[model samples]
Target chain A: MSIEVENIHKQFGSFTALNDVTLSIPSGELVALLGPSGSGKTTLLRIIAGLERADSGRILFNGEDTTEHHVRERKVGFVFQHYALFKHMTVFDNVAFGLNVRPRGTRPSKSEINAKVMDLLRLVQLEGLAQRYPAQLSGGQRQRIALARALAVEPQVLLLDEPFGALDAQVRAELRRWLRKLHDEIHVTSVFVTHDQEEALEVADRIVVMNKGRIEQAGTPDLVYDHPANPFVLNFLGNVNLFHGRLNQPGADQHGADENAVSYVRSHDIEIERSPQDSTALKAEIRHIQKLGPSVRVTLAIDATGEFIEAELTRDVFKNLGLQQSEQVYVRPRQVRVFVEDYQI
Target chain B: MSAPTTTYAAKANDNHRITEPALVRWGLTVVALVFLAMFLVLPLAAVFSQAFEKGLDVYLTALKEPDTLSSIKLTLITAAVAVPLNLVFGVMAAWAIAKFTFPGKNLLITLIDLPFSVSPVISGLIFVLLFGRQGWLGPWLDAHDTKIVFAVPGIILATIFVTFPFIARELIPLMEAQGRDEEEAALVLGASGLQTFFRVTLPNIKWGIIYGVILCNARAMGEFGAVSVVSGHIRGSTNTVPLHVEILYNEYNYTAAFAVASLLAFLALITLVVKTVAEWKVRQQLGR
Candidate 1:
């Protein structure tokens, strides 16, 4: 089901958690709410799930207004950070709970409930753990069981709040990949909250970057990475070499922006050459160079701008050039992304 | 001179040998054993030894008296009413205090703890001041022909007052420590508020609740001063076991009083067992 949150606002006492935040998830899209801690990403996801009420807004599901629906009436499945499994119940019983507690008119027979729970358990590859309580399972297994329990009710929208936040680094990566695969197979409209930028970039079809109870940016990972709407988005997405330089005409009008417009270039787009011959090239002395697995991060000072520039190079390219610290090099900007200072905020 | 020095050295060695770590540890254990024997074990032994001194038939005859039987029955009845009521109040208060923040929260918490700090005798006096014929609201109660003081209600009120904090005190910290995450998760999973409370919140706090119930019941059953003040210590009407024991002691009926006190002690022992089991279960669950 498609989910639409229109101008949602939430406040806890004097602190605003969400400020007129708006977003829409098309049916079957696995959108991610990504931000750092206290960034209001989780709050937004909770509002969507009806676990938290929005102070001012409306949430529509499949084009019908569900702003006043209770969380139980909203039919949104949720998986929590710590699994939040019912410690007293078996895996099968936990999964069958939603089905068994169906409202007045909708009742499932014993065999039907059992079949549905087993099917969900099988789907999560936890069929053998049906009789075991949640405490018996490992962290990853418990999370998978939490997922299966969320799915057992056949919810319209699946909401996960920092679903892998508590797991170890290795398990988190595996679960992210597995979740992506599962989302593809299930084709459920899912919204998952995460503070890890890498996890969001890797797992989400579209990422909503939040900051201080507001959306900083929202787009596909590539778009947000390559073309950040603001400095916050750029710094949040990944490492960047932000240079303060005025855009000079290449003797004529550039691709789009007028001359004298200030712009910045991404580290990957800056070409470092052995010779300082190009007219557009800027001369710099390397200060430090750290060898990453496939790429080398070179920190250098740009002579004209007196700004620190971070440059990235592939291992093969660095080896071929045989660069060293304190070595003078020329950097030519192949592509520059421009932003007017007045329009930044 | 050399002989004298050698003898002195030998005495020093003897002192050092006597002050070994093992010797110190044993000394400490002996001291603890003496204290336990004097205070706890000896007193209990005295109660049992004195009760059976008159033989089994004498104890049976004492128990057969209508006053003793009625006091036991009344005590049990009061406990039955007080324990469950305290349990409900404790859970509700814990839920409210641990789960929400509101105005007068600190004051409300202090009020919950008042029964623990106030003397049991004072607790009975407060009830008497409000419910006695010459006290506040006494006129209204008298006009309505309600006999709260010197009756079962008065006995229950005193028991309830002293035992009020036990269950809630056990549960509040536990519930606060567990937090609202599990309940919120249940809500998001479409569990109704009541279902979430029973299935998620209750299971997690069950041990705390049990621990609280045992403590409340123990206090409720053994309460003496407060119930005596409010129940008027009437022989057949409002006399509780503790009051009846006091009456027997005053009448020089030593064997019977000791017998009844022993019974109350046994009930307290049962409560202690329940508490130990609850603690063990909590420990085992946490260890896993």
Candidate 2:
């Protein structure tokens, strides 16, 4: 099943949580609503799940309006950030809750529920912990159990609000990978809300970046990252060096590529050398050097503008150059992207 | 050098400890114990001691009196009617207050504690003004041939008025701390609204509800000021145990009055035990 949200607007008192937001998801695709706190990603996800009502808009499930439907009538699965597992219930019963709460005509038999719940437990690799209550499990274990519970009902759509937001760093990374693999295996239409950009880039098939209750951009991960439509998306995606320099060279305005006054450049796109023969090259001084595992980052300040920028170099290249702090260097922009003043969302 | 350093460390450790001096600790303990003995233990012991003053046979006869037995029944009935009604109203009010936002929310919360701020006598008098024979509703009730004042209904209403805030006050903070995340999760999982409440919300706050009910029921059975104003001191029908005790004492029936007073004290003791157990259960649930 596919899901569509159109012109959704939600407000809490005078605060606008979502503003004229619209998006559509194809069947079996994993989409992410990515933004900072108070950016309304979670509110938009809740509206799609029918847990929250929109101020004015419609939600469609395969082209049929479900705006006025009750949450229980939506047939959607929702997972919370804090893992709202039933503390009074054992893990086995928590997973079986959806099946047990079904109406009499469609309810499964007792043995069938047991088998299905056990199967879900095994799927989450928590079959051994089935008899344990939620309080007895670790945070990672509880979240995994919550996911298994959300999946038990065979929902047509799945919504997760920061599913890994509460886990520690190590467990969060592990669960992120596990969730991606699980989605590939199940392939149900899914939308997850997260503020972690790396998670959106790594796990989601499509990323919708939001800012101040507005959709900044929505596209494939690389499309939104490499070809961000506006400055907000570019700055929010990752580390980048921004500049506004004049370039009167031949194709500065002709070719679509190098329309120099390169508005922004990624850190890796900034190239540094000991010396350059070209007059157009910018002169800079190295301020600091940080050696990461396989790459070294050189922080430099432009001698002319006093502006700072970062250039990432391979370990092999850095060793060959023998660069040091306080050293004079020439820098060049290897790749450039422009964010126009008249940009539209 | 090492010896001097060790001695200095020991002196610093003594200063670091937060323990009070022996003299101060003992003084505070003695003061508290003296006050408890003077104000609490002695009065409770006197109730039992005076009941047995006329010998075991006389105590037994006082308890067996039909007036005393009927008063006990009336007290139990008042609590039986009042406690459950307040329990339902308290849970609904707490749920609405803690989980939803609407106009006059702060006003509603302050009003829930209205009975607590108002004197029990005034609470009883308010009902009397509404339903008594010479009051506003008196003429309408007389035409309908219905009697509310000086009746069991009036007694129950007064008891309920004084105890209504107990459960709601207890549950509000607890339900607030445990946000509505679980309820929303249940709803998205296809559980109906009623199912979500019974399965999720009620189970989460069950211990709090029990603790509140114990306190409310204890107060309902022991209420004197409110029930006295409305009950009119009828012999059998409207005389609760507290009112009966007062009447017997006024008539110089000391032995019978003390006998019933001891029973009320026993009820208080049982209430403390159950309240503590329920509180401990709540602590354990939260600790998890």
Candidate 3:
């Protein structure tokens, strides 16, 4: 199933949750609505699921309008951030809830329902916990069971709102990979909302970056990360050292930035070396050096400007430099991207 | 004195006591226990002791009186009518307050708690002033040959007003803490509003519902001030249990009055037991 949202606008009192947002997800693609908190990613997902109503917009499932539809009629499986599993129901019963609530004529027989629930439980790898209540299970197990319950009705679209947000770091990482494999096998039109950029990049096939209730950029992970549309997208994706001075300065590489625009250079794009007698690289003194496992991050202050910028180098290369704190060195950017407009970090 | 003070400090250090000294602690404990005995336990024991003061036979005869039996029946009827109605209203109001946002929500909650802050006699009078013979709607009711004030309907109305807040008060905090996530999940899973309430929401708050009902029922049966005003003390007709107790005590029928009062006390004891069980059930569910 394909999901389409057109001209959606939602307001909470004076605050705008989504501002004329439009998005279209093709069938069988795992897309992520990625943004920081209050960026309207969750609001868009809820509107798509019919859990929330847009002020004026149309939601279409496979090109059929479903804007007026109730959440139950939308046939979109939604998983909540907190894994809102029914606390009083057993895992099997929770998974079987949708089927059990169906009208008698359309409802499956008891045996068929039982089999289907058990099969879904197995798919989530929680078949052994069929009889256990939700509180008895670990956080990861509870979330998997939540997903299985959502899948029991065979929804046309799967929507998850920070499905692993409540889990610890290790469990979150494990589930991120597991969800990617699960999506491949199931191939539902899945759209998951997440603020964790790494999770979105690693798990989603396409990423929609939203900021301040608007879609800033949407594309495959590599495209958005490498060729961001604006400064917000660039800064949001990863660490970047921003420069406000005019371009063509000493040791500054302007790949796309014009002379007057602000420059943004990735931390790893910086090169540090001892100044040769003839070198024209920007003169700087290393202020601080942090040795991460694979790379060393050195904070350098430019002599001409007294501004601090970070440079990253692999451990082997950094070791060859024999750098010490407060040692004088020259720095140069290898690649720089600049946007014309100003945006606060 | 210095030696004793040193010993007290040593004991405080031994226990890592952050509270007051042993003298103050023991004094406060003794005071509270004595207060409980004076106010709660003694009065409760007096009700039973006075009832049986004459003899077991006299006590039995007093309860077996026609007026006493009728009052008991009337109290039961009032509770039966008032509690279920409040339960429905309480659940609906709590659902609206806890789950959704709208205008005047805080006002509605304040109005729901109006009975608790207002005097019970005034609560009864408000209904009377609207339904009494000379009240706002009194002439209209009189024209239709209907009676409300100082009647069974008025008694039931008064009881309902005082006890309605109990269930809603118990449920709002519970539902607010529980959040609407589970209910929203149920709706997304294809369950209808009614189905979600029954299957997911009701089961989760079943113990809370029971706890509120027990408290409400106890209040409904034992209400004195509100029912006293609305009930015209028409013995064997409109007299509820508390009204009958007042009538007996006023007429110097001390034995009968305490006998009837003992019955209400017994109901209260039973309510306490049931309430404790419900609270335990809530704890167990939450512990899960």
Candidate 4:
């Protein structure tokens, strides 16, 4: 079901954890709460899961008020960073625990519970390890078992708190893809918390970038990547060479798309050459050169303004141009996106 | 063929070989072993020798007497009642101390360990002042026709008070070491607090609780001074094994007294075994 979080506020004594944070996820949508640590992403997730109550907020589940509901009554499943499986129980028992703890008057038959646990085990690809304890499972296997356990109750919403944060890089990547596939098959409305930008970019259908207890940007992957709402969103999302220069004109040549007139160019949009071509071109001194696989990242500083910029080129281009450190070079912007500058988004 | 080279290689191997520590450690270890044998082993040897020197038939006959049988039965029954009750209380108290930061928490912890610091004789006196025939609650209880002192209830109360902190103290460090992540995770998984306690919290603290209960039971079965003061030491009625041993000694029944004392000591030895096994099991589970 669709979930709506309206103007949520939370404070731990004097520390304001989340400040009037608000967002909505449609039914069957997979949203990622993307932010660095202490940015209120996990706090927001816990609020939605009903693990923590907000100082002021209204949460609606399919237009019904669920703010006062306890976590058990919320029908929301949660998977934690450490997996939180019962160490004394076997993998089978761990997965069956949620179903076994069903509310009064709704207890399932033993056979029904067994069948559901088996189905979940197979879904998580841990069918062969049903009798093994949580202590006997690897990090990735334990997390999968945790996921299976969370899904056992057939919850309406699933919340994952950095589910892959504890795994090694390779395992994190593998589980990230597996989670996306699982979400696609199940089509349950889900929200996952993560501080890793690559994970948020690759796994989620929509990304909500948070900073300092506020939403900096929220959109589809392409929308955020191609059109970040502000400097924080852009710098947090990916590598970008930022230029701070005033726009001289609004002509097509200057590539200023907005009237207010300052522009930011992507590192990939800056072209470096041996010869100057137009009035837009400026001479810069090469400060540093780094070879990255087939490309070379050349850091350049403009001579006139002493402003720094970075440009990426093919290794072949670097060889052809014969650029050296401290050598004079010509640089021009191939494309620029201009936006209205504001302190808040 | 290469005699000189082979000699050099042998010398190199000798230089690289690890040398064990010298004889000083071995001499100290032998001294320590002799000291342990003299101080710890000789007394136990004397107890066994004195108990059994009269032969099997005499020992069995002494053990089969109604007084001795009742004492053994009483100790077992009291421990059975006290251990499980302490186990439950211990876990709840440990959870409170380890997980929550509340007012009076430190005071509560200190109160829990009060029995350990106070003399068992003093402990019994405090209870006597509160529950004795002429004490504060004594008249009220007598008016209601209730009994607390000089009975089975008195023995149980004395045993419970003395052994109260054993299990909780053992579990506090363990629960603290595991931290709060798993419990919080269970809370988030739609498990109510009770369900979370049973499924998540209980399993982690199970070994520590077992170890603590074994120690408490061993101590409860052998407790003398407190139960003596509270129960008035009525023969075959309020006499636990330790109290029974004291009575036999007073009556010039030295052989039977040592025999019964040795039996209680055997139970204590078994408790040690159980505690060791519990620790090993905990380590095995942690290894996983």
Candidate-wise lDDT, in order: 0.86, 0.90, 0.91, 0.86
Q: After superposing candidate 3, which stretches have Cα over 4 Å from the reference? A: A246-260, A276-280, A291-294, B1-20, B284-288
Off by over 4 Å in 2: A244-262, A286-299, A310-327, A340-345, B1-22
Q: What is each candidate's fraction of native interface contacts (fnat)?
A: 0.69, 0.84, 0.86, 0.65
Q: Which ten residues in a row have the lowest lDDT in candidate 1 chain A?
A: A247-256
Report RMSD (Å) for each prediction in the order shown: 7.5, 3.7, 4.2, 5.1
Give the poorly placed runs of model 4, Cα more than 4 Å off. A103-115, A240-345, B1-20, B24-28, B31-39, B61-67, B97-103, B142-147, B177-195, B247-253
Identify the CAPRI category of the predicted complex in candidate 1. medium
Decoy 3 TM-score against native: 0.94
Report the C-alpha lDDT of model 3 over A1-345, residue by residue, as the tens digit. Answer: 998889999999999999999988999999999999999999999999999999998999999999999999999899999899899999999999999999898999999999999999889988899899898999999999999999999999999999999999999999999999999999999999999999999999999999989999999999999888888888888878876665444544334445447888888988888864444467899999998889999999988888888988999989998999989988877677767744555
TM-score of the B chain in each candidate versus the native B chain: 0.90, 0.93, 0.92, 0.90
Candidate 3: Cα lDDT at A23:
89
Give the deviation of candidate 4 from the true structure as CA RMSD.
5.1
Per-candidate TM-score against the hidden true structure: 0.88, 0.92, 0.94, 0.84
Strongest candidate by TM-score: 3
lDDT of 2 by residue, A231-345 (tens): 6788788878866554323332222343333456778877787788577568999999999999999999998889899888899989999998999999887666665444332
For model 1, chain A alone compared with the true chain A gives a TM-score of 0.90
Per-candidate interface DockQ score: 0.50, 0.74, 0.75, 0.47
